[model samples]
Target chain A: MTQSAGLVAEAILPTFTEAVELHKSMVFSIAWHFLRDRSRAEELSQDVFLELHRRWGSLRSAEHLVFWLRKVTGNRAIDMIRSRKVRPETSLDAAAEPTTLEQMHDSLLASYLERMVATLPEKQRLAIVMRYQEDLEPDEIARILGMNVSTVKTNIARALSLLQAKTVGRLQPNTARRLNEMPGETGK
Target chain B: MTPFEQELKRALARQQPSADFTERLFARIEEEQAAAPVRWWQRIAQWPAQTIWALAPVCVLILLTSGTMLYTQHRRAVQGEHAKQQLLLALRITSNKLQATQRQVNEVESERQPNQKDNIRRLL
Candidate 1:
């Protein structure tokens, strides 16, 4: 009995550590995107990981691990929003500063689109950031934010409208044409 | 729900975190694990801390309420004691006046008795 118990404990220990490492990117990205600052995101992400360590026993599977992390990140962001007496200025759609992507020749239109997304309301901003920036689906965004499917849809809709409107006058004629050439640029 | 939504997703997915994220996270995690297991008391201290936090306001409220009640009662008792003393002093003064009036009446009666006795002897 003792041998079996020890084996089980040893087996579970590595898995817990592996789980934290595996989801760190997704967790950190969510926090950073919501907070719009790297340092705060890092701190928040560390808090989430610590919480995950504390609750390791209750999580049953890999899928549950991702679900819990995403959900907690969203809830924590919202809690941060509610609890804070002062809100710092954040530009959601702003392109990441001077990264390889910005230096690359391709996707200038996409960069413009990001700047437009930054002006959206916090909820809409988070939804769009998670959906597009993190490649999360609407349903997944709903799960993370603890909102119903329709509300998530509304947030996405409002975000896209804002992006489209902002992009119309900002992009040059050729870049605008290129953006419109994209498949989802126009209504069906 | 429109096509623009899809394009927005395509645009945003290109952004990624700095490459060193995984390496940093592992280093932090290992450092934490190598450290000592938190004492059981530390693990459980939040409950007691929260209990004390929650109880602090109630304790303050009870102290304030009891203090106010005791102060009011003390004031009322002092006032009652002061009124009783004044009433006793007033009664003492009234009793002394009454005693003085009685002594004067006794003196008058003695003087009137002597005058009446002389008149009666002369008439006999």
Candidate 2:
């Protein structure tokens, strides 16, 4: 009995190590993007993994594990935002004019969009992050967020429209036109 | 597929945790484990429900035993206090009796001494 117990204990470390290696980036990225603070994000990521370790026995498969991590990370991020009561200043209508076309190069554009996404409401920010960053479907996001599919769809659509509005005149004409023609534009 | 989203995705790409993140987590786990080593009772609490059920009678027995011991100890204390009260009452009664006997003896001795004096006077 002792030998078997020792073996099981030894086996758990490697298994947990691999799991952490596989999912740490996703966990850390979700927290980082949501909180925009590297240290806090790392702390939250560690907490999520610790919780995952505690509840590891309940997770049935790799897919379920990924889903669980995403759900927990997103929920924790939203909780942090709510607790902080950070009223984002940048609203859809209040968004400043986009950066000049010359300044909207690849890296700059990426950073600009990131900043814009960060300025959304907590739910919309999480929705957009999950939709684009995690590449999750609306239904999957709904499942993770414990919201209706329609609500998730609405959030994603509104967020995309807002992003489009924010970036409209900043990029080249072709890029701005493409942004306007994004998937969520018709629903508005 | 919009350029804006593509940019957003690139901007928000998966970031790695701190270089020592895993090590710190492990240390935390170990520290937590060390801080709260499971006690015997806690281990019992974590046992399966059936095992806990099986131990219910033993728990009841232990509770009853301890309760009986405490009750006996309380009863003994009460009994001892009653005995102490009885002893104090007996001592008070004995003291009163001794005082009464001494007064009687003093009265008798006084009476005898006066008779002896009268007898000596008659002899003289």
Candidate 3:
């Protein structure tokens, strides 16, 4: 190629792997929570980063780039969810025994919460996952989802209400006790 | 918004990816940026010169066209002065109406003579 084209090509070849790793977790979590399939999650996550690679210059800053990745990954996950509406939710424990009451704890709570989050409506599910899993503020979630901050807060509130209603009587006393005793319970 | 949300935050905070994620992302960006074959020396050489090169032909064309336009304008201005001189000469040679024309001109000049004399007296 011409010298200019060569220059362009050289400029683009150096940062492939770093972009892949930076977005791997967020992308993978979004996909995994929506699909409940690790392999699918990994594949989708890689696809999301590959896309980010293609459009890296359009992103303004590191934080802006992360927001773009989260938005794209969330939209792709919702598309996957709707496409598979007729099929069953993929269970990670197909070969293992069902979760027993004895195994319920903080770690189990995270897992349960992940599964329960997957069961929410697309917007609510994504907003809650971003808020909780990514520790993003409501305004950040709004920016990522292209929604208003109030809308993001409402989605999170609704998702929590649904989770609270569903698990109100189902949670064992021990699980409730553990939740109450969870570290940093500043008890306001 | 509540203790439960705060607890949920604590629980979910543990889901970070394997430690190498940022390094991987930066590496990928570097790789992509590096793919272009323009050597560093070539980039340094071309940066300032490229814009000048791209605009050079257009600049030359504009200058050429403007020179041509100015020449035409100069020619038109000369032609306009020549026309005015011809008109004046024709007016001077028109003997048939010269007397009547000079009589009317003298009357108009007489009417404005007081104003011109007053202005000159003020300036002096």
- What is every candidate's C-alpha DockQ against the true complex, given to 2 decimals? 0.10, 0.21, 0.10
Clashing pairs in 2: none
lDDT of each residue in A1-188, candidate 2, tens digit only: 11121233223223567778777888888887787778888989999988876665455456667778889999998887788774455655676775465456777777777777888888988988887777777888899999999998889878877777667766787767765665554221
lDDT, candidate 1, A68-170, per-residue tens? 8778887787677667732445344453334443233336655445545545677887887777656566787788788897898888767666666556445
Candidate 3: tens digits of C-alpha lDDT, residues B53-107: 7778999999999999999999999999999999998887886488889999999
Off by over 4 Å in 2: A1-14, A86-102, A181-188, B39-124
**DockQ of structure 1:** 0.10
Return the TM-scores of chain A for each candidate in numbered order.
Answer: 0.73, 0.81, 0.74
**Winning model by lDDT:** 2
TM-score, cand. 3 vs. native: 0.55
Which regions in candidate 3 have their CA more than 4 angstroms from the true location?
A: A1-14, A86-99, A177-188, B1-3, B10-124
Q: Poorest 10 consecutive residues of model 1 chain B by lDDT?
A: B41-50
- Poorest lDDT segment (10 consecutive residues) of candidate 2 chain A: A1-10
